[model samples]
Target: MSYSDTNDPAFESMGNAAHYTNIASTLFFAYAVVSFVKDDANDPLFDKSWKQDGFCVTHKEIPFWNSHDACLYFDMMAALLLGALYWKQRNALGMERVNEIFGPSILGILAHGIGHGAVAHRMREMGLPTLAEEDDLDKTTIDENINERIMEINMMDDILGVGEVSERGRNVFVMVCFWVGLMKAALPNLRMAPFAAMVLAAMAGQQFVDRQFAFTYVQTILLVAFSVNQLARKKEEKDFVYATHPMVVGVPVTFIGWIESTQCSAFVKDSFYGHLIYDGFIPVAMLVWYVVCYLQIKESRDNSFESIAKTADRKGKVKVS
Candidate 1:
């Protein structure tokens, strides 16, 4: 927070770059970890399972920072940093305005971090075929693996297990936060009406659907609306970067995320590297939008003070006196 508050503009950029590099290092480390484990499944934890069940059914996760189970952990850190950034700005921007604009995203990131990291991670303990071998499996074997993969979706629909119920409920809460932010950030228009309604419908029926789909499309929808809003604002402001910079980083990657989820979904589900690139842009997207909102509020405050002049200029305009 103080980093951004300082007069040096490079401070915040440097901090962000450092955090990005740290995460990138973890990802490369994970790839090497995966290679080592598979090359010698003799690691005690996997030795028994690997021998008895073959590599397909043996769990490949490293407890601390595995590919799939660690996103929630990173999400927690991101939420904390994001919260700190907003905390310093809230008072200057007005608490209510900040809450309306930013509070949901901060809470949503934190909430999902806990939900996915703890709850969903536990649900994913069962091993599926590794990325290297998924292509070689026969129909029946592949069918079985597919069922195993859908266990999360099926569990969400069960309504009997208390854990699944709680997890789904938590996801729904995150869904609401996203919807609230979408409403606040995007200017309403007839053009966006149908898309908004469809998202609401999907969200309302999340128990029957894969929660990830809702998240992907919610982002796609929000980004489009956000871009349009920025375009409209650019007309009034005559500042291209102010209106378009957020879109520069967010839109194409999000569209790639959308495509990856729908077309190459199996790859994303099967590979750690795939998930890192496909699903990882999420936090990046959230931060871009948060920055956009911050700039908007600051712009408003700066513009508000310029309309009235000081007494020196008011000397000729003191008709009121």
Candidate 2:
């Protein structure tokens, strides 16, 4: 089953995508689980994300554990999977793909986890509201301008008011990840697509760091289109699952990501429970992707087929006799 002599150019690409899908799904599922389980009542004041006066803390204040902590742990899981995935593929598919396929996305997500950790630490050190309402803040304890501080989290656009440098740095890095990914893709390097997708995801995302309503739909639709294209292919490779399964995870990830934006009346979109459900879905979607990826890689190793019939299609891959 080793693909050492396979003629398909997509061997490495498919292998790498499966790996990414695994991490992404697990990371996403963690986000969802944490959101559901994090109980303000169970938390001591020190561990909660709100201040004494009811203002929202900018940091993920839990000492040993928090959402960022969950993400880092997931990143560790990703590292392990990456190591295993890399080892298998390099031996079977060839070592030449090691850096070219796996390096950037893995590194990007790791950096993203580090950035989140930094933001959490730095913001906790500052000890002020990154998100707050005027009523939540006490009038007398601090010297910062109240007008500059108060921002309603309920509104989408008001996130602009958060002026923390660490937060901004994280966002800027996310954008940079996407930009670099685009540059790679511009050269027709499809290998980097997952990295760019991670950029938009806030690193192997079950959650978009900055969520937008219509934007979620676009992501969902595009990924679905990708799945459809793979499914419609006239020639199904031995690695057909490799081509389609990763994209299949996209449907639920986008749907879960879209739930918050739905504003459905029955869903209580304005409630804390709603927030928990939305955040919770992030990890669920991620976990789904992980499962698919795991299956894909396992299948690839077991099903490496030789003598692929190179046929022409509308996309313009040249036909071979």
Candidate 3:
């Protein structure tokens, strides 16, 4: 009758981790929002661009500065709310409570995975074109394609009934918002080198330990992978679909960075065996998971085939019935 016997801790830990992540996320986000509100001025980077095609000039301004800001604020708010809920229920909820949060957590993870994955795939499919080539693509066409994909993914979620957005998407949105807000507020003059370093550290932390601990690690890895893959393939990689694609190079690297960050942090720094708990461990774990899932799926298929084949063979042996 004990809760320990009835529920799995692995599932529960995910929820607890997510709850803590939300707490940190909220603090960062609040800082972002207050900073933005106080400094509502626009930067030159936000300027629009114009392209001329024959006699016509097309003008484009990036969408939703305000909306992006709002999303960042709201994402932080959501994280804070989740943190509060976790704090309230930590003692009474047990593993089931943690398990319950997995649905949302996974959804967030998948969202981020797909969004960036798709972008990488698309860039690859586009053949690693120059900025000019990318600009040449009709913005509306690109937007439509993105919208279509988003809709298709949304439908898949609807069928699954897990929640609205995928985990990856939520992660990407929230992380991006956090980064943008941070840049806008505290690090307005941030250089690429320092930004890259932060990204590397954050990525190292997230992949090895937990993503919530440091989200930027994921972004850094994604960008670097995309750059490297474009160089290696000599052709654009395919637009990312759901499965693990060539663009997945980012995942492992970021995971490594995250692990590093976790170990360095105050809470985990002195923990036992912390030295062995680097982000490098993530790849080994992922490889194991991949093999296990593949083997299980293959076994199921093989068994299904055997069952059908046996049934047919039995029927063949029988007289006309």
Q: Name the top lDDT candidate.
A: 1
Ranking by lDDT: 1, 2, 3
Q: 1-321, model 3: which lDDT tens digit per residue?
A: 222222223423433333334334434433342333223264111111100100010111222211122222333444355445445644542223222322233233333333333333322333432345557677666544433432232222222223345755754554454333332222223467875565445433443522121233333333343333223321122111112211232244334333433233333223422212322232333333333333444454566679999999899889565
Please write out the lDDT profile of model 1 over residues 100-123, one tens digit for every residue: 435555665565555345433444
Between candidates 2 and 3, which one is better according to lDDT? 2
Using lDDT as the yardstick, the better of models 1 and 2 is 1
Model 1: CA > 4 A from native: 1-60, 94-99, 124-153, 157-159, 162-204, 210-253, 262-272, 292-300, 303-307, 310-312, 316-321
Give TM-scores for every candidate, taking all chains together and pairing residue i with residue i.
0.47, 0.39, 0.24
Taking all chains together, the TM-score of candidate 3 against the true structure is 0.24
Error of 2 at 13 (Å): 20
lDDT score at residue 266, model 1, on the 0-100 scale: 43
> Candidate 3 local accuracy as lDDT?
0.33
Candidate 2 lDDT trough over 10 residues, lowest sum: 46-55
Clashing pairs in 1: none
**Top model number, TM-score:** 1
Model 2 error, position 205 (Å): 18
Model 2: per-residue Cα lDDT over 188-250, one tens digit each:
234457645633443333223232122232233334333443343334332434443455444
